[model samples]
Every structure is written in C-alpha cells, then in structure tokens.
Target chain A: MSLAERMLKIDRRIIFLVIGLCTLLPLLYPVGLPIRISSEVRGVYDHMESLPERSVFLLSIDFDPASKPELHPQAIALLRHAFRKDLRVIAMTLWVSGTGMAEQLVTQVAKEMGKEYGKDYAFLGWSPGGQAVIINMGQDLYSAFPSDYGGKPTKDLPVLDGVRNLKDVAYMVSLGAGRPGVEEWYVFGKDKYKFELGGGCTGVMAPGLYPLLRSGQINGLIGGLRGAAEYESLIGQKGKAVAGMDAQSATHLAIIVLVIICNVFYLSLQRAARTQRQIG
Target chain B: MDATILGAWVATGLTLLIFSFLYKDNPLFKLAEHLYVGVSVGYTIVKAYDTVIVHLVIKPIIENGEFALLIPVAIGMLMLTRYVPKAAWMSRYAFAFIVGMGAGLAIPRTISSFILKQIEDTVRPVLSLAGPDGVTFSMNRLSIAGLGKGWHEPASSFS
Candidate 1:
C-alpha cells in the first residue's frame, strides 16, 4: 500500500493510545515549563491583594465532578490564596455533586493553612433556587443562605457578623462550570447589588467569558487548567494544575506532530502517484 | 500494610480494566458506566428533594407557617403534568414560573454584564497611567488602560 493509504487506514485505537500516552507521561513527570500569566488571572489575584485584611469574599464552587479535572484545581488555588492572605472566605457550591468535593478540598486546604471554619471561613452548601437565592442575598443574606454546609445558622457565624448583603462583600470569585456560574454572579450579585466580581471556568466555557473579561464585567478570569496553573504559580504553591499543564502541552504538541507527519506522508504519496501516471 | 497496598492494587486494576475499553469495547466498561450513571442519578434526586422539598417547602411551612409557599408547591406539582400528554398544557404554569423567574433573574444581569460592562470597558481608554507611576508598565495597560496611577503620557503617543 502507498504510504498515504497506510496513513489514512491507521487504527483509531492507535491514535487513542498515542493521545493517552502523550497526556499520561507528562503528568507522571512534569517539565516545569514557564507559564505566561494572563491578566485575567492577575485581575483576581490583584483584586484579592487590593482587599483589606479580613475582607468578606464569596468563593463559589459552581461545578461538578465531570469538571473536577478543570475546576477543582481552580477552587483549591483560590482557596489557598484567600487563606494565605487571611481573607475571610465563605465557600459554597451551586452544583450538588460538587458540595462534598468542594467541602473536602476546602477543609483540607484550610487545615494545611491552620484556618478555622466558623471563625476564619464558612462553607454555605448548595442552594436550589440559584439566581433567586443570589437576588435574595441582596435583600437579606440570612434568608438566602440560612445555614452553613454543616447546617449551622449563617446569621450566628462569627465570621459573617457584619456580612449582610453583596454590598458588604469586598469581592466575589465564582469558580464555575456552567449556568449559574460567573454569569449569574455578574448579573444577580454584581449588577443590581454592585459587587466586584471575577471567575474561573472550564476550558470549553473560557472563550465565551473573554468578552466579559475585556469589558471588566468580571475583574479577572482563571481559564481552564492553564488558568489554575498560573494562579498556582502566583501563590508560589505547585499543585495538580501545574502538573496537568505539562500533560496539556505534551498532548497538544503530539496532536500537532501527528497532523504534520500525516500531511507529509500524504503529499509524498501523491507525488509518487503522479510520477507513476506520467511514466505509464 | 499488605491490605492497604492490595486495596490500592485493586483500585489500579479496576481503573486499568475500565480504561482498557478505550482500546476496544468491553463488558467491564459497560458495567462501570452503568453503575456510575445509576449512582449519579440517585444522588441528584436525593439532593433535589432535600433542597427543593425539604428546605424550600417543608421547612418553610413547618418553621414559619408561611402557607404562601403553596403557590410554589402547586407550581412544583404542575411539573409532573409533563408525563400526561393531554394535561401537558397544565405544565405551562410551571414552565412559565421557571422561565419567568429565570428571565427575571437573567435579564437584569445580562444588561449589567454584557451591555453596561461592554460599554464601560470599551469606551474607557487604556492610557491612563496614574495607577502605576513606574517607568514601565505591563502591556495590559498599553492595550486597555483605564484610570491608572503611574503613566502620564499615553504609550501610543510615545511610539
């Protein structure tokens, strides 16, 4: 068979295997490549930096497990930043599946940083009425999220003493995946209530948010695994996002190389076929 | 020690077993995929009931005696009308309530987020250097400078 024919007929399983190996190998041993920090990420970091100590910030984990490989790292990186800065954080999840995972992550990171829950941070678990809850927060904070993730009244939490509405919030970062994510926050919270807003989103949804970032609707954006890596870099704490970047880079480059090789093989075969036809 | 390591080994084995289907279709992947779906759906239902019924409905009535919740309770029941084709129009109240609330929730945010914010960020200049007085500033300032502290002259003017 001609080289082009052979290339065209290569098994899809081989391609899958190649892609898997390309992604897996770098994850096992990372290259520590220097990452360019986008302003979208720096915006959130800068916003947090600019906040006074103990500023009330809402860190919303509006994502689920399917997005864990992307959004989980963002949650961790942001939580780590908030804790490091001694910012009073209120963690919550709009996604049901994310509640347990987000809680586990926050607890682990908080412990690592010696953070106390009710005193330093509080996690107000999932709420069903999404945007209604956000709007209700504008009118009455306790009515919106009456209880913390553990079922303690948010009204009585020492950390939330004076925090009554979005106006009381210094800045809000919504680490999100889909509907009721950054968009919901900007509209419900930042629009009418007028709170500073930012977000971190999965790769697939990142492009849609660029216009928002450009407009300053959101102060910053941490996009996909790359955003998480950049945020991790800023905090000077390497974690899963950084590891995943190596994998991402390797996989992207592998796909490019495969495309190039296939094209070259195709062109060579075409030239050979033309020569044979001319002679015949 | 052996048991813990063995458990890890078993986990690794199951992972590989499930992943092997990427090379080709297999019963193991099917079983795992079905179990995952089942568990996920169960979790979602329980969560929904806890939040929607228990918290929003049951708790409200029990704690506050806010019988006004029946409006939402009726709307919630209307959602079941979807299963009966003849009575599907009865579901419109539920749809309208949900969609209306969604729109009420979405429209204002859309205006603030997309409309107002777009104008603010776009019409704003990128050359205000009052924010950073350093000799050099990041290129972000060069592109969309909005009221910064440091640079007096526009970078465009310098070039």
Candidate 2:
C-alpha cells in the first residue's frame, strides 16, 4: 500500500498506547512547567479573597467518584482559601452519591485549617428534588435544609447564625460534573436569591460555559485539573493539582507529536504510490 | 456482633466482585446491577414519601394551618388523576402550572444572571494606569489583553 493509505490504516491501539504513555510518564516523573493563570481562575480566587472575614459562602459538591480527580482538588483548594481567609463556609451536595464524599472532604479540609464545624462551617448534606430543592433554598434555606448533613437543625449552628435564604450568602460555588450543576444553580438559586455565582467544571463543560463567564453569569470558572493547578499556585500550595500538571502537559504534547508523525508518513506513502503509478 | 460492619464487608466484597467484570462479563455484574437498581428504587420511594409528608403536607399545615395545605393537596390529587384516562387531560393543567411557575421563576433570574451581569464584567477596559496620587502611572499591559489593538492611542492601546 501507498504511504498515505498505510497511514490511514494505522492501528488505533498504537495510538491508545502512545496516548497512555504520554499521560503516564509525567505522572510518574516530575517536571514543573510555568502555568499561566487564566482570568477565569483568578476571578474565582479574587472573589473568595474579597469576602470579609467570617462571611458566609455556600460551596456545593455536585459530583461523584467518576469526577473526583478533576474536582476534588478544586474543592480542597477552595476550602483552603476560604478557611485561610477566615470566611465561614457552608458546604452541601445535591447528589446522593456525592454526599458522603463532600462531607468527608469538608470535614478533612476544615480540620486541617482548624475550622470548627457549626462554628466556621456547616454541611447541609444531600436532599432529593433537584431544582425544587434549589428553589426551596432560595425561598428559605431552613425549609430546604432543615437540618445539617448529620441531622442537626441548621438554625442552631453558629456558622449559620442569621442566615435565612440565599440573601445571606456572599457567593455560591459548585464543583460540578454534569447536570444539576452550575446551570441549575444559575437558574434557580442565584437568580432570585441574588448571590454571586461561580463554578469548577470538568473540561468538556468548560468551553460552553465561557459565554456565561464572558457575560458574567459566572464570575469565574476553574476548568479541569489545569484550573485546579492554577488555584493551587495562587494559594502558594503545591499539592495534587501541581503534581497532576506534569502528566497533563506531557500527554498533550505527546498527542500533538504523534499526529504530526502520522501525517508525514501518510504523505510519504501517497507520493510513493503516485510515482509507481506513473512508471507503470 | 454488629450488622452495619457485616453489611459494609458484604458491600465491599460485592463491589470487588462487580468490578471484576471489567475484565470480562459474568453473573456477578448482573447480580450487582440488579441489586443496585432494586436498592435505588426502594430508596427513591422512601425519600419521595419523606419529601411529600414534610414539604408538601405536614410542615405547611404546621406553619400556615389547614388552609395552607389545600392547594398542594389538590395538586397531589391532580397528579393521581394521571392514572384515569378520562381525567388525564386535567393532569396537564397541573403539569402546566408546575412547569409555568418554574419557568416564570427562572426567566427574570436568567436575564439578570446570564445576561446583564456578564455584559457588565466583559465591557471593562483592560488598562488604567492611575495611581493613588493620580500622578504616577504603571504600564503593565498584557499582549493577550491587547491582541487586536495598536500600542498608541488609549482606545487602541492593547496590542
């Protein structure tokens, strides 16, 4: 077969193996590339920074295990920022599977920063009725989340003293995997309630939300692990996000190189075929 | 001695067994899948009842007395009417009301959040060299911000 034809017929398994190695190498080794922090990431950091000490902010973990790698770091970094600034955080989840994970992370990060539960932070846990729950929260937080994630009444929590509805919230941020995420919050929670809104989403959903970010529907967005890394940089903390960046950068470059090589080989095959046909 | 710990171990074993299907399909995957669906349905039903009793029925009545409960009670009955073919059309009104209220509640918020707020942020100028005393100026313009503009006039000062 001609070189072009051969290129077209290249086995896909080879590509997969190449891509897998590209992704794995940086993960195993260590190289720190200079990361340019996008305006979107800076916006989120700035928003959190601008909050007064002890101000209440709502952080929703609306994802599950499948999205942990991309989103967990975001949750950790944001919580660190909030706690470091002495901001009061109220963490919760709308997804059932996310409840335990969110709860665990919230407690862990809060403990690391010496934040007292019910004093510096509170968790409302998970509830059913996706958008309905948001609307209920807008109208009255107590009505929707009558109790803490652990089943204690929210009204009694020192962290939530005087918080009634979304009005009292300084900002609402959700680390989302899919539906019932930033979109739902923008529609039901932030609209009538009038709180500043932001999100951290997996890469696939990031580009589509840019229009919203451009227009300010979301004040800022942290997209994928790159975003998590940028956030870590801003906080001066080099954790998993920084560690993951090497893998991401290496994998992307490897994919690009492979594409170029495949194309060159393909053209060579085509040229050889044409020369043979002319001679014959 | 404890049922919870025993249940946890059982769950752990089942999870490992189910994940083993990633290597190849087997009876274990099927069993796990069925158990997952069954447990999920049961949980959903119980949760539904809890929501209904608390949000739709008991709490409203407790807060606002019997009169407050009637409207939602009627809606609940309207939902039930879906089973009767003759009364199916009436259920549309209930659905319509629910959908309409949701949309009505959403549109204004959407306008403010997704529209107005975003415009306000993006339209700001990228450079302003003003200092605290208004005499000292700083020039740290980013090329990324000035991509399309020439570096001369204030209006054209980005690129």
Give the share of true interchain contacts found in each model.
Answer: 0.79, 0.41
Clashing pairs in model 2?
Answer: A3-A269, A4-A269, A4-A270, A215-B118, A216-B118, B146-B158, B146-B159
User: Which lDDT tens digits does candidate 1 get at residues B84-139?
Assistant: 99999999989998998787657656755676456555545543343343123222
TM-score of chain B of each: 0.66, 0.68
DockQ of each: 0.37, 0.21
User: How do the residues A1-280 of candidate 1 rate in per-residue lDDT, one tens digit apiece?
Assistant: 8658888789988998899998899988888888999988999999898988898988989988779999888989898888888999988877887777788888999999999989999988888777777888888888778777777878889999799887898888998899878888877777778789999999989999999887657889999999999999999998999999999999999999999998898888888989999999
- Candidate 2 structure quality by residue, lDDT tens digits, B1-159: 599699789888887777666556789888987887787667656655665576546865787676766786788689888899999888988899889987876666665566544544443433323322212111222222323433332432110
Question: What is the alpha-carbon lDDT of model 1 when measured against the actual structure?
Answer: 0.83
Candidates' C-alpha lDDT: 0.83, 0.80
Tens digit of per-residue lDDT, candidate 2, span A178-238: 9789888887776556789999999888997888787566899999999999999999987
Give the DockQ-based CAPRI class for model 1: acceptable
DockQ of 1: 0.37
Q: Which runs of model 1 end up more than 4 angstroms from their true locations?
A: A273-280, B1-18, B84-88, B123-159
